[model samples]
Target: MSARWRLAPGERAVWLTATTLFLLVTAAWLEHQITWYLAVDQFGYLTFAHDLLAGRVYHEWAPFQWLARTIPPRTDALAQAYVYDHGRLYCRYSPGFPILLASWIGLLGDDAAHYLNLTLFLVLLSVLIAVQWRLLRSRWRALAGTVPIVVLPTSVYLWALTPTREVAAHLSAFTGLFLLLRAGGRGLAPWRTAIAGVALGYAASVRPDAILYLVPATLLVAVHLRRRRSPFGVVARIGVVGAIGVVVGLLPALAYNWTATGNPFRSTQGMELDQFLAPLPRSEPTPAGGAVGYPSPGWHGGTTSDVQGGGLRLANLPRTLPANLAFLIEAYTPALLAAVVWGGVVALMVRPLVFVTAVPYGIVALLLYSCWPRPDPRYLIGVNLLLPMLLVEGTVGTLDLVRRLAWRGRVEAARRLAFVAAAGMVLALVGAFALRPSTSFGRLAVPILLIAAGGAGMAATWPSRRVVAIVAPLLALTLTGIAVARAWDGLDRRAGFQRPQMLRARDTFRRAVEPRAIVITTEDIGRPAENIEYYSGVAHALYLTDLARWHGSVFGVALLAIQAGVRPYLLLPVSDPERPKILKQLAGVFSLETVRDIPPAQAVEYFVAAPFHRGVHLLLERITWPGFEKEKQGGPPG
Candidate 1:
C-alpha cells in the first residue's frame, strides 16, 4: 500500500497555516511592488472612471471605458453628470476595463480605484490557487502550480502599479479557466457548473480572446455527459441551464455594446473611428497638381490601423501558429517557457483533459495576440495562469516516481544526491536574481526554487498524503513572498533612477495650470501630460495629443469671437529629431509673436505664449524671453 494513503491531523494544520500565510504575504508584496512600479497606467484608468461617472457614452478619446460602467456611481452628483460634459463622448478605446474601474469608483472614490484593481488582481490570484488545489486534490501539485504565478517575475513586475486592461484581462481569463475546469467533470456539482458558466461568460466579456475557450469547454462537457449515458432530458436540462447562465452573465457586455455602438458584437466604434480619423491629416496633396489640399490621407499599412485586417487573417490559419507561438515566447519571460513545457509534459500525464482544454485556449490567445499591432506582455497575462497548474501536475508525477524508487531502496542514494544537486541549483539561481535583477534570472530562479522546495518539502512528509498536501502550499507561499520582496526593491530602484528631463517634466506640469486658464502644449510630452491632467483637475486644459490642434483651432475661434483676453501661461519647447524643421518653424513663429521664456531649471526653459491673433501683443507680453543668455545656458527640454 502507498504510504500517502495514511495522514495525521496536526501535520495537516501546520501545512495549511503555512500555505495560507505564504500566499497572503506574496499577494500583498506583489500588489505593492506592481502598484509602485507601474502606477502610470492607473492614470489612464482613472481618466476613464472620471469620464464614466460623468455619463459620456463614447469610448473613443478614452479607451477602456467599458470597464468603468461596472461600478455604480458613488454620488448622485457624479451619477447625474453628463458624459459629454465630462469629455467622455470623445473617448476612443474598448470599454471592458473602464466598466470595471467605474464600479470601483462608485463603491469607493476615484482615489481608491487603483487599490480596487490591485485587490481584484490579488483576489483572482487567490481564487486561481484555490481552484487548482480543489481540482488537483494534492497540496504539492497546487502549490507547484500557484507558486510560479505568485512569484512570476513579469507578473510581479507589471502588477506593481499599473491598473491596465491587461491586468483585468488576466483576471477574466483565470476566472474562465477556473469555471471551465470546475464545471466539466464528474466531481463537479450542478451549482458549481452553473457558477462556472457565469464566470466563463464574464471572462469572455473582459477579453474577447477568452471566448475561444467556450467551444472547447462546451465540447468537453458534452462529451463527458454523453459518455455517462444520462437520460435525454438530463442532457437537455444541463444545456438549458448552462446556456441561460452564459447569457445572463454576458448580458451586461451585450447591453453595453448594443447601447453604445448600435451593434452588440462591435466594440466602441466611436473610439475606432476617432483613432482612424485622428491619424489622417486635415489636408492632403492633390496627386494631379503637385499642390497640397484637404482630406489628408486614407488608412495605409501600419501597426495600429492594421489590427482589424490582422484579426481577419488570424481567424483562419494553421500556418500562423508558429508566429503566434513565437509572439507568446517573446512576450513572456523565460520562466514561463520552462514552466509551460514542464507543466505541459506533466499535465498530459496526470490530467490529459486539462491539457487538452488548455491547448486550444493557449493557441487562440497566441493567435489573437499575434494579430495585434502592439504585442504587449500584459495581453497574455491570464493565458499564462494555466501554466502553474500544469507545473503542479508535472512535479507531482515526477515525485511519485521518485517515491516508488525510494521505497524499493535500490536507487535511494542516487535520488538523494540528485535532490541535493537540484537544491543547490535553486539556491544559486535565487541568489543570482537577488543580486542582479534580470528578467531571465528571476524567471528561471523563482520556478526552480519553488518546484525544488515544494518537491523536497512534500517528499519529507510523503506517504502521508495529508502532510504533503499541507506543506506544499506553505512552501509555495514562502517562495512567492521572497520573490515579491525582491521584486519590490528592484522596481523601487528602477523608478528612482530617472534622468534630468524626466524630473523637469514632473516639475513643469506641477506649476503650469491655474484655476481656469487652458494649458496647451505639444503632444507626446510623456509624463508631463499625465502629471498635469492628474494633479490639476484640468483635463481639457492640457492638450497633449494631435487632437489638441483641432481643439486649439476651436478655442482660437472662440477667443476671437468673444474677445476674451488670453495670455501665455507657459510654453515648453518640444524637441523632435524627425521634424526638426517643424520645431524650428514653431520656435521662430513663437519668437516672432514675442513669447517669453521662463527659466524653470538649467535643463528646461519654460516659455509663456498667448493665443495668436487674439490680443497678439498681450500674448507677446505674457511670453517673456528669459533672454538669449537663458537659452544658451539651458538646452531645450529633452
Candidate 2:
C-alpha cells in the first residue's frame, strides 16, 4: 500500500477545511455565472479586446471620410470621437482589465471571456481565504471569511463576473497588505519588501484609486524598518528597490497611454466627458426647427443630467454626495457592517497591524469616490472586497478573547452572561427581520426591544462552554444563510445580469434578417445594443447617432450610409411614435423599402430603411464593386 494512505488527525482536518472552502467558493462562482450579466463596463472592455485582436487600437464603426461633407465642423474632440469611434470607443477606463481580457480571448475566443473571469474569481477568492486563515484561524474567522465570498455584495459580484480592473485591484491591494503585515511581524526581508511594493504598484496600474493605499502602505513599510534600527544605508536601499519595482509595474500602463492618446497621464475620455457635460450650442436644428440651447443635454449615456445639469462643477459634489453614500451603505450590507465593527475592536486589542492591512484602502476609496458626480459603486469594488477582511479579523479576535477568558477561569459568570446576551441579540435580529418595519417607530422599537431582551436574557441563562460553542456555530450558519438569501434577492431585484427578453429579440432579429448588412439604430441604443454587437456576434451594427451629430433627425445618416454602398437598415422599436416621423423623413429623402419586419413577439418590430429592391439591384449592377469576386469566394480581395 502507498504511504500516502495514512494521515494524522490534524492533517485530515486541514484537508477538510480546504475542501469545504473550495466547495463553498465554487458554489458562489456558479451562482454568479447563472446570472451572467453584462454591463457598460463589460461591453467596453470586451469591445476593446475585440478591437485589439482585429489589429486596431480603435474600432472603426462607420466611414467618417464624408463627415465634413455633411455636418458643420465642431472643435470638440468628444464630439469628434462620437463621429469617429462610433460610440464603440474605449476611454475613461484603465487598460489592465481589457488587456488581460484580450489575452484570454486570444487563447480561447470571445465566448471564453466570461468563463475565464469565473476562473479568475475562484483563484482570487482562494488566495484571500488562505491569507485570512493564516492571519486568524478559528471557526468564527473561517465562517466570517466564507460569508463575504459566498454572499458577495451586488457591486462586488458584478465586477467579479465582468472583465474589469476592480477584481485585479482587489487581488493586488489585499495581497500587498497581507504581505506587508507578515513582514511587520517577521522582520521585513528585502525580497518581501520588494514583492509587496510590486504588488501595490500593480494594484495602482489596475485602478488609479489604488494609489490611495499604495502611498500610505509604502510609508508604513519605511517607518517600520526605521523603527527596527536598520542602518540608514539599508533603509535607503530598500526604498530604492521598492520604488523601482513600483515604476516597473506602472511602465506598461504609462507607455500604452502615451502611445495611444499622446498623453501618458490621462485619456481623452475625461475631456470628452467635459465637453459632453458642458452646455454647448446645438449645431443642428431641433424638431421645432430652431437650434436648441441647454443647461445640460437630457441624454442618458453621456452623463448624469439631474446632478450635473450642464457641467460637472464644484457645486455638484455636495448635491451628489448623499445618493452616493446611500448606495455605498446599501452595498455594504448589515452583516458586513457588524463584522467590521467586531473586526475593528479585535484589531485594536491584539492586531494593530491588521487595521492598516485592508481598512485604509476602504476608507480612502470611500472618501475618494464620494465626490464622483456619478454614483457608480463599480469603480470602488476593490474597497468593497477589503472591508470584509477587517470584519472577519474582528470576529475572530473577539472569539479568541472569549476562549482565552474561559481557559483562564476568570469571569465564569460574566462569560455565561455574555453568551446569554449574544443569544438574545441573535434572536432580536431574527425578530427585526421578521417584522421589517416601515415606520420610524417600528425601527426604534425593534432595537429597543432587542437591547431590553438581551439585558433580561443575560440574567436568566447559565449555559455550559460546550453549549455556547455549539450555539455560536449554529448562529453563524443561520446568519450566513440569511446573507446569501438577501444577496440573491437583491440581485433578482436589480437585474444587473439580466435583460433576457431584449437579448432574445436581438438574436431573433439577427437570424431573421440579412446576415451581412449594416444595422443603425434611430436613437442612442444603450447597453442592450452594445451587448448585441459584442456578445451577439453582430459586428456590422452601428448606432445612427454615433455616425453623425444628427441632433434629432436621421437624414444625413441615411445619406451617408447609402453613399458607402452598404444596405442601410433603420431600426426602431415597434411601439415608438417617432418611427412614423423617421420613416416619412427617409421617404422624403430616398426611396424607402422594407428589408425585414421583426414581429413584436420576436423583437420590438422594426423597419429596414433602404432603397427599393429594384433600385438597389440596379445600383449594385452599375457599381461593379471590385471586392465582389472575393466576397463570393469568402475571402478578401488583394
Candidate 3:
C-alpha cells in the first residue's frame, strides 16, 4: 500500500488508467452476468475449478444435478467434451487455468467467481503496468508520451473477458517479459534469470503455447553472450539454471497430465492433432441390455466432442492464411504497426539486444500461427500486447533521430515544417470524421482526430522530441473511449441474441421434466452436460458416440440411457437427414417422440444480423426425447 503511494504522478496515472479500464469491464460483467461470452472452455474451467475445490482431481461424471424444473443453456457449444481413458472419464484440457481459478471460485461463490477472477487479474495487471511504467521511465522517459496507448485496442478488452486461457497467458507472459527485461539490465543474476524462467513457465502452465516466448528470450541471451564474448561455461551455467527453473515451474502441469491421462505430453484439448481427421468408423458391440448394441470405441479427433469424419486439412492452410492474416491485422489496428516497425528500428538503433531476445519469439509466433490448421484470432493475443511496447520504443527512436538531426543544424526550419504538417493532418481527420458514413467508422474517427491532435500538439511544442508524452495518453484515452462503447454494444448484442433463448430453453426444460430424471442426449458436449449437472445432481449424460462402437451415430445414446435404469431422452435435430435413420434404428429397441421443440440458437445469427442469420437458423434447431415416464416400458415405439 505504501509502495503504491510512492509512485510518481505519471506512474500513478498508469495504475489509475488500468484500474479504470478494469472497472468498465467489470461493470459490463455485472450487467451481463456470468452467462455472457459463455464458451465451452469456460464451462470446463468453471466445472474443473469446482472439482478442484471439492478435493477431486479427475471428474468421472458430470457434476451438476437439480430438480428438473429448469436447466441453464450451455452457451459454449463447441467446447470439448470429457474424454474416456480406459473407461474412466476425465476432462480433456490442461488443468493450469482451472487450478488457479479454483481458489478464487471458492472464495467468491459461483455467481461472483468470474468477477473475482478478473479483479485479481486487474491487481496483477496493475503491477505489471507499474513495473513496465517504471522501466519505460528509466530507459526512455520519452515513453511517458506514449502512456495513453495503454487503453489498448477494443479487441483486447473483448479477449480479456473471454473464458480462454489467453488472459492468464497474457499476464504470465507480460510478467515474465518485465522480469526478463529487468534481469537483462541488472547483471543477469542467477536468481533473476531463474525467477523469470519460472514466470514464463507458469505462463505455459496456463496455456502451453506460451512456451514459445522463451524461444526468443533464449536466442537473445545467446546473441548477447556471443556479442560480449562470454565464456562457454558461463553461457552453459545460465542455460542450465533457466532450464531448471522452467522445469520446476512446469512440474505440476506435467504431473497433473500424467495422472489424468497417463501422458504428460498429451493435452486434453488435443489441439495439436487435427480434430476433424478422425479414424474410419468400424462396427463394435454395445453393452448388454444397452438400447443400441456395442460399446463405442473412443478416438481423438478435432476439438469437438462428437465424432467427426472431416475437417479443414493442412492443405487448406494456404487458402485460410489470407483471411486469417487480414483478421489478425484488423484485430490489432489500435496499436497500428508501430510496435512491429518501431520495435525493430529501436532494437537496431538503441538496444540491439532486444531484437536478439524478443523479436525472434514474435517471428516464431507468426510462423506458428500462420501454419496452424485453424486460425483463431485469440492465439495471437500475446503478440498484440508486445506490439505496444515496440510502438513505444519506435516513438522514442524517432525522437532520438530528430534530436540527432537537430544537432546537425536546421532545427527551426524542421520544427516549423512539422507544426504545419501536424495542423494539416488534424484538419484532415476532423473533415473525415464529419464525412464518415457508418457508426463504426465514426467511432474510429474520433480516435484518429485525437491522434492527430497529439501530433499537432507535439509539433507546436517543437524541439521537444518526446512526442510519446503528448501522444501516448491522448491516444490511450481515445482508444479507451472507443473500447468502452464497444464493450457495451458487445454485451448488449450477446444478451439480445443468446441470453433470451437460453433462459427460455432452461425454463422450458424445467417445466417439461421432473426432478432427478436422467437426460440422455446427443448434445453431450461439456457445456450442456456441465450446466445440467450443475443444476441437477444427475450428471449422467452421454454423447451419441458414447454408446455404439461405430463412430458418428446416435444409436448408442438410447442404449446407455436404458442401461442406467432410466428411460432415455434425446435432444437432436429433428429435420436432420440422419434423423429418420436414427429413429428407425431405435424403432424396436426404445420408443422415440418429440418432447419439445428447441428453436434455433445459432450464435452466428445473433452476431451477423437479418439475412445472414436466416442461413443457419434452419440448420441448428433441435428436438428432445419422449416425455418422461415414471416406469419403463419394454415395448418398441408406438
Candidate 4:
C-alpha cells in the first residue's frame, strides 16, 4: 500500500488565504491596468467576436467599408486593422481568439468576459500542479512549483488587464507541453500526445508566433518516445497520430480564412500584414512641428511602427539577446541569468530528461522574444509562466548534482559552492534594488557577480539553502516590483499608457454625432471610433488623414462620402496650425459648424517621441453640406 501526503487544517487555511490574496492582487492590477492603451488588436478581436455571435462569417460588408478600402490616408498600424477581400471587410486578427471570446461572450455577459484571464490562468496553474505532481508524486513539490506564479510579481499581471489572446495562448501551449510530461516517458500514451498536439496547434492559431515553442517541445517528446527499446514502428505510429491531431486542431482557422478570403490557405490578416519580414526604419525625431501639420508623428506604441528597432535589432542576436536578458532580469530577478544558466547546466548533466521537458519552453520563449522587434515588457509574459517550474526543476537538479558529488567524496567542495550560492543571492539583491541599473554594464554585472563573489559575507547564524527557497523569492518579488515600477515610467513614456479620460472626452464628442457619422481624426488623441461603436449600436469608419500634405485629396473623398449621404465630422487638435486652414477649406465646400471642444484627456501618447506625460486637446467640427442633404449637391464640402 502507498501513502499520500495531505495538508493539515491550518495549512489548508493558510494556502486558501494566500491564493485569495493573490487573486485579489491580480484583480486590482486588472482594474488599474498599471499602464496600457486600447490598441487595434483589442478592438479588432472584439469586432470579430461580435460578428461571430451575429451568426455570420466574421467580416463586414457595409458601404462605409467600401470607403475604407478606397481611402488614401489609411495607416495600417494606426487604425483598425481591416482587410478588404472578396467584397467583405475582415478585421485582420486570427479567428481562433475571437472564436474563444465569442464563446465566452455567449456563455457570460460582455462584462464578465475579462474574467477569462483570471479563469484561464487558474486552469493553467491547476494543470501545472498536476504535471509536477505526476512527475514527483509529492504535494509539497507541486505547491513549490505553483507558488512563484501565485506569489511573485510576474508579467501575467501586465497581460491580464488587456483583452488580448495572451492568457489563452499561454494556457493552451503550457497545457499541451505539460500533458505530455504527465504521460510517463517510457509508456506509449498516444492519446496524451495527440491532445498535446491539438493544444499546441490551437495555440499557434491564436498567436502565430506561439508555435516557436513547439520546436523544443517536439525535441523533448521525441527524446521520450525513443527512451524505451521500442520498435521504430510504434514510435512512428504515435507521431503520426499527433500530426493528425494538429491538422484537426487547425481546421477552425483554415475554415475561417476560407470563409473570409475564399482561400483556406490565406488569411485576411496575412493579406495586409505580410510585411513583417521587411524591416521597418527607426523613428527619427521630427521637430515639434514638422513641415506637415501632423502632430509630430503621433502616439500609440503598440506595434512595429512605434519602437521596432529601438535599441535591439532582430537579426543581431549578440546585442539583442543581452538586452532581452536584461529585461527578463528586471522582470523576475537580477539573479535570473545566473539561476537559469546554472539550472540548465546542472539539469542537463544530472537530469537530461527533466531538462528537455521543462527548461526548453523558457529557453525557446527567451530566444523567440529576442528576435521580436517589439521591446515591450509584455513580450516576456510567456517566459514568466515557465520560471516557477524552471526554478523548481533547477533547484532539484542542483541538489541532485551536489548529492552525487558528496557520494563521490566531494562534500567540502559542495558546501563551499552552497555558501557562494547564498552569497550570490545577496549580490543580486544589492544590484537590483540599491543601484541604478540603467547602463547595460550595470544590468549584466549583477548575475556575473553571483558566480565569483568569493569574499561575500556569510553569517554562521544564516539560514540554510532550504530556508532561502522561501526568502529569496520574497526578495525577488520586491526586486521585480521595484524594477517594474522603474520600467513603468519608461513604458508610459514609450508605450501608449493613458487614462480613460479619453472615454469621457469621447462621450461628449459622441453626443454631438449620430452612429452613422464618420469622424475624420487628424489628431491622435485616440482612434476613438471603435469604442464609440462599442457604446453606441454602431459607428462609421474613422478615416485617418495625413498631416498636411494630403488633406486636400482626403477632404475631397470626405465630400464624396457626404454626397453618398454620409455625415462627416473633422476631429482636430486645437494647437494644430493646420486646423484653421482645414476648416477654411471645408467651409468653401459646405456649411461647417463647431460641435464642441474635446477636453484634454489625461494621457501620455508618444509616437516614440519625447514623453509629454500630459493630455492634448481636440476641436470637433461638424462638416455639413445642406446642399447635399436638401438638394443632393456635392463636389467639395460646399
Candidate 5:
C-alpha cells in the first residue's frame, strides 16, 4: 500500500536464503518419505487413471466391471471409496484429480502418479511466495510470513503425502486472493471472478464440502464492485457469471455420478451418511436393520458406540466441537497455533476484506466438521491456507503495536526483564540440545525449537536492524529444519510401524489362496494398504464392509460364498484369549484352519506424538468344509 513496504537489502538476502533452504528441505522430505503409490482416496484416483488411459469415460473396464456383475457376493460387496451399482464399480470421488493423475501416468508410466503431489507442492509453494510478496510488498516477510510449509506437520503430510486435490485446494485459495485483489477497482472483469469460482468448484469436486472457499472470494468481489460504484445490474451479472462458472466446472462431476452410479445426485459420501449416521428407530429397529457396525464374530463384542442419537444434529455441537478442536491441537505445529492467535487479529479485525471472508468461511468450515460423526483434521485444510497470510499482516500489526508502546515511553525495567527471560529460554533450549541430544526434551527439540524460534521471529521482527533482518530468516530456516527433522522422524516412525503390517498383509494376500483363489479379509488389505481399495480386487483381497450393512456376519457371508461355488480365504484378527471361542464360532458354519499367524508390532514408540502401528496380531485362515475343492476349475485366477 506504500513505498515504505518495499524490501530492504538485508531482507532480500534473508528471503533468498530461506527460500533456498526451504527447497532443499522439501526435496529431502519428498525423497525420504514418499511412497511409490498414492494412499487412501488418492488410491482410487490412481485406479481411475487406468480406465482413463484405456479411453473409457465412465469406468468401463470390462474385466473388473464384469466381475462385479457376475460375482455372487455382489449384494454385499464394493470397494472402499466406491459404490457398486448393477454390475459396475464407481469410484465415489469426483474425477478432477484422477484426470490430472491420469495424464502423468499416461505420459511417464505409473510411478508418476506419486510424483504429482510433489509437483503440486512446488507449484503451491511458488504460488504462496508470489502471493505473499504481492500482499506484503516485502520479500523477507513473504517467505516466513507465508508460513513455513512445515509449520503444520499435519499439513506437510496432508499436502505432500495425501490427496493432490488438497494441494490444489490450497493453491486455488491463495490464487483466489491474488485474482480478487487484481479484479478489484475494476469495471467488471467478470472473467476474473468466474475463473476464481471455477477453481473453487473444481476443488469441491474432491472435497464436496470445500465450496466454503467461495465465501471469501464472493464477499470480496461484491464489496469491491459496489465500492467502485458499479451499477447493481453489472454486479448482479458478474455474480451470475460466477455462479455459472461453478456449475460449468461441476458438469464433469454431475455427468460422472449420472453415468457411474445411475443417480445424478447420489454420492458414496451421502451413502455413508446414511449407513454410518442414520439412526435406528428406538422402539423397534428400522426396516434397514439399524445402523451397521462390524461386530467382531460372535465370540466377542466390538465397541457398542455410545451414541445417543444418530445422524448430524445441532444438539451434538457441545460434544463434537470440543472433540474436533482437540483433534486439531494434536495435529497442528506449535508455530501454526501461534500464527492462528496473533495473525488472527489481522484476519478478523484489521482488514475488512480479509475479515469478511476469513471469519465466515473459517467458522463455517470448522462448525460443519465439528458436527460430523468423525471429523478428521484434514477437512479444515482449505480454510487453513488463510492463516499464513494473516500471519504476514500480523507481523505488521505487531510492529505497529511495538512502535506505539515505544512512543508511550513505557518502563525500561520491564522491557529488560522480558528480553532476559527470552534469552534465558533460548539458552536453555540450546544447552539441552547441544549437551544431551538424546534426552527426551532434546529428542523433541525440533517442535520445541520451532515453537520458540518461529513464534519469536514472527511476533517480533525488529525490521530496522540489519542483524535482526539476517537473523530473522536464519531463525526461520532453523525452524524449518527443526520441523523437517521432526517430520522426517515421524515419517520414519510410521514407516517402521506400518512395515510389519504391510509386509505381512502383502505376504498373506499372496499366499492366502492358490493360483485362482480369493481371500476375504476383515479389512481391505491390498498390496500396500487397506485404505487403498482400488488394488484390493486386483489383488483378490476382499473385505467384510461390503456386506456390513446387511449383517456383519463373516461366516454368514462365508457360507453364502461357498454356496455360490466360490471359496474365499478368511483373513481375521484373533485375540489370543478368545482364540478358542472364535474357532468355535467358525466351526459352526464350516471347519477352518488358521494358515498363518501374523505377529504384532515389535516395539513401542515413545517420542512421536502419534505412533502409527498395529498393536494386534492377525490370522490368515482357510475353510476346510466338505467338497471345498469341487469348484476348483471355476472363476478367474487371483
Candidate 6:
C-alpha cells in the first residue's frame, strides 16, 4: 500500500493542517517581529494604502493606487462608512498587489491585511512547488526542488510581509512559465492559454521590466512548436495568446498615462519632474557668513543625475550602476549568493532548460539594479524565487541520471561514490543549518534526520517504495519546519509601536494644523517620511529646489504649493540647512511659527535632525543654532 494510503484520514488532515499553519505562523511572525529595519519604500506603500483610505486623489502616479481604489465594500457598518467617506485612492505601483491588500482590508480590516498578504504569498509559493513536482514526476525530487526557496533568507524576509508589486509580479511570471511548459506543443486549450496570458499580463503590469519575459517566453513556445513541425495554426494560437497577454497587462499603465499626462507612455517620470524638479530660488546671503543653497543635484525619475537644460540627463551612469549593484548584493542575505552559485553550477551540469529560464530573468534583474538609482532589495526578490527553483530541479535531475546509470549496471562503483559524497554533503548542510545565525542548535535535530533521509534516497539500493517512504515525509517536514521556524523568529523581533512613531507624528501634526496645511520639507521628507496627506488629513505640496542655482526642486514645489494654498500647514522640520532662507521665503507668504521642535529639548530643531533622534537630545541641544526668528508682521523679506 502507498504510504499516503496507509496514513489514517484524520492523521493526513492533521499533517496537512500542521504544515500550512507552520507556514502561516512563520510568515506572520517574520513580517511583524523580524529585527531587520523596515525600508523607506515599505513606508511609502503603507502611506499610499493609508491615503487610499482617505478621499485624496492627487498622488495617482503609483500603480498600486488603482488596486487600493477597487477594494470591495464590506457589510460591516464602520468599514462601509470608512470606504464611502475616505477611499479616494491613487497609487504609483501596479494595481494587482494593492488591490489584493484592499480586498483583505475590506474583508477583515487593517489588522488582518498583512497576514492575508503573507497567506497569499505562501499559497503562490506552494503552487510553484507543485508545478515543479508535476514536471519532475518524483515527490522526493519535488521536495528538494522547493527547499532553497523556503529556506533562503531573503525569501523568508519577503514571505512575512505585505504584498509588494514585485512579489505579485514574480508569482504571475512563474505561473505563466508553468502554464507555458504544460501547454508545450499540445497547443493550449483556448481557455487555459487565455488564463495563462492574463496571468502573464498581470505580471507585466506589476513590473514593466517583466515585458522582457514575454518575448523570450513566446520564442520558447514557438521553438517548441516549430520542432514539432506544427501547422500555421500553432503559430497563430501562440501569437494570439502572447499579444492578448501583453496588451491586457499594459492597459492599466497606458490608461493612467493618458489620463494623467496626455501620453500613453508617460510614466512616473512626468510626475516626478512636475513635483520634484523645477529649480529653487537662490538663497539670500545669511548674516552669519556665506550663503547656503541646496546640496549637489538630486535624482530625477529612474535616472540618478541632475536636470540639464530643463530636462534630466543620464550623466551619472558610470557612478550609479556599480553602487546600485553593490547595494542590491548587500540587501540580500548570504544565502541568496549561495543559491545563485549553486543554481549556476547545477544548471551548467544538468537540466539546461531550467538554466535557460533563469538566465534572462537574472540579466534583466542585473540591468535594472545597475541602471536604476534606487537600490531597493525588493526589486531583486524575483531572482531569489527563480534561482532556488532552478537549483533544486537541476540537482534532482542529475541525481536521477546517476540512479539510471546504477540501475543499468554501467557505473555501480560511480553510483556508490556519488551516494557517499551526497551523504557527506547532506551532513555539511546540516552543520550549516546548525550554524545559521537564527536557528537553534537543538532545533536542527529534524534537519539532520531529513539529511539522512536524502542520503537514503541517494543510495537507491533499497526498493523504491522504501526510499519513498523514508524520504517524502522527511522532506515535507523539513520544508515546513524551516518556514515555520524562520517565521517565528521574524515575528518575535518586530519593531511594534516604535516603528509606527512616524505615522503617529503625522497624525499629531494633522490634528494641530488647519485643513490646508502648507507643509514644506526636503524632497526626501515627502511621501515616505511624513506621509503627510495620509496621517495629517490635509492637502500639502512639495518644496522643490531650482535646478540652475540649486537642485532641490521638490522643496521648491513644496513652497510654491504652500503659497498657492494647495498646502496650508507650514510643516517645516529643523534639518533644513537653509532654514533662514526658507523662513525668509515663507515670511512673505504667511505667519511663521516654530510650533514644535520634535525632541523638545533642542533649541534649533530641524525636520532632518528628527530622524537622528537616538538618545542624543544633549548632542542636538549642543549643535542647535537659532537663526530663523518669526518676522514680526512682515509681508515680504526686506
TM-score of 3: 0.71
Q: Please say which candidate is ahead in TM-score: 3 or 4.
A: 4
Each candidate structure's TM-score, on Cα atoms with residue i matched to residue i, is: 0.65, 0.71, 0.71, 0.77, 0.72, 0.66
Off by over 4 Å in 6: 1-15, 30-116, 138-150, 159-163, 181-187, 219-229, 261-356, 373-375, 394-397, 413-473, 497-507, 523-530, 539-576, 580-591, 600-638
lDDT of 4 by residue, 308-374 (tens): 2232334534445777676666555555546666766766776565567557777776776765443
**TM-score, structure 5 vs. true:** 0.72
Instruction: Identify the superior model by TM-score, candidate 1 or candidate 2.
Output: 2
RMSD of each: 11.6, 9.6, 9.1, 7.0, 8.0, 10.5
- Which candidate, 2 or 6, has the higher TM-score? 2
Model 2 spans with C-alpha error above 4 angstroms: 1-39, 54-56, 65-91, 137-143, 183-185, 219-229, 268-299, 303-320, 328-339, 401-516, 522-528, 535-539, 544-553, 604-638
Overall lDDT per candidate, in order of appearance: 0.47, 0.50, 0.50, 0.55, 0.52, 0.46
- Candidate 2 per-residue lDDT, tens place, 21-121, comes to 44554545454443333344555667667777777775554434444344434222122222123333334456666677788989997557766555666
Candidate 2 TM-score versus the reference: 0.71
Clashing pairs in 4: 589-637, 589-638, 590-637, 590-638
Residue-wise C-alpha lDDT for candidate 1, range 24-105, written one tens digit per residue:
6655554444321112344555666666777865434321132123222311111111123233342223456777888888
Cα shift from native, residue 495, model 1 (Å):
5.2
Poorly placed runs, candidate 4 (over 4 Å): 1-17, 28-37, 61-80, 129-154, 183-188, 261-263, 271-297, 300-322, 392-397, 407-409, 427-434, 437-510, 543-554, 601-614, 630-638
Comparison by lDDT, 2 against 4, better one: 4
Best candidate according to TM-score: 4
lDDT of 6 at 597: 42
Superposed by TM-score, candidate 4 places the C-alpha of residue 556 at a distance from the truth, in angstroms, of 2.4
